[model samples]
Target: MRRWRGRFLARLRAIAPRYPPRREVDRQARADMAASSVEGGLPGRRRANPSMLPRRIPLYRELIRATFQPE
Candidate 1:
């Protein structure tokens, strides 16, 4: 058991430096998303459908159209 544990830990330590920590990976992903968004890259997630707005809210529909379909 002791030998196995030692081998496992030694292998882990040797491999650890090859990968960034989870938090660092997440931070980098967020930064990349922000940069892409600023550059008008494709959205990472689906956007809401403007057609889903109630007919009573013409202003909302117009705003959505104006924002997404710029003349």
Candidate 2:
């Protein structure tokens, strides 16, 4: 679920910057991604915290676009 959302978001971000400045949004997105990559407790049971998804969607969309649609 999380991964899927990330991919989706990366695509969106890749398209065109909407809210705020791209620089600020990009920086914040990267930080959010980092926060969601931690190994939670329990075996075969990873959990994504509330704040972990601040940039998963948009960031994912942007990532997809960037890798595939280069200028």
Candidate 3:
């Protein structure tokens, strides 16, 4: 019974995905982010402007409607 259990655990370990250590994973993520930023693959945050509120917000939609009335 003990040998069978050990063999089963070993087989499971062999089939399981091997993940990098936490520190290594973090380092890789940082490196990827840095590379993407350098290559312009990642977008930077938009500068805060009162006139440029996100369109998805109700307040922004109301502001747009108020600013542009139809003749």
Candidate 4:
């Protein structure tokens, strides 16, 4: 089972794309596709340094509370 699983995975990896598309006449299309897919995705919040951001005080408090709460 293990040997067959390893061979199957190796074959799958070999079939995957090996490089980014080379830029050419299709560069605009590729760029637009990439931008639409990536930028249209959800907005993400970056974590500011806790000491620099007062908002993180309550976040840390909640996290600590959840960690110690009985499960």
Best-fitting candidate, scored by TM-score: 1
What tens digits encode model 3's per-residue C-alpha lDDT throughout 1-71? 34434553453344334432322223333334333333332122333443233322445334333433333
Candidate 4 backbone clash number:
0
Candidate 2's TM-score reads 0.27
Candidate No. with top lDDT: 2
Q: Could you give candidate 1's per-residue lDDT for residues 1-71 as a string of tens digits?
A: 34434543454345436543333233333334333333332232234533332332455334333433423
Q: Which ten contiguous residues of candidate 2 have the minimum total lDDT?
A: 37-46
Q: Let me know the TM-score candidate 4 reaches against the reference structure.
A: 0.25
lDDT of 3 at 62: 48
What TM-score should be assigned to candidate 1? 0.29
**Over 4 Å off in model 4, which ranges?**
1-25, 43-71
Clashes of 1: 0
| All candidates in order of lDDT, best leading | 2, 1, 4, 3
Better of 2 and 3 by TM-score: 2
Worst 10 residues of 1 by lDDT: 37-46
Each model's TM-score, in the order given? 0.29, 0.27, 0.24, 0.25
Badly placed stretches (over 4 Å) of model 3 are 18-71
* Candidate 1 lDDT: 0.38
Query: What lDDT score is found at residue 36 in candidate 1?
Result: 38
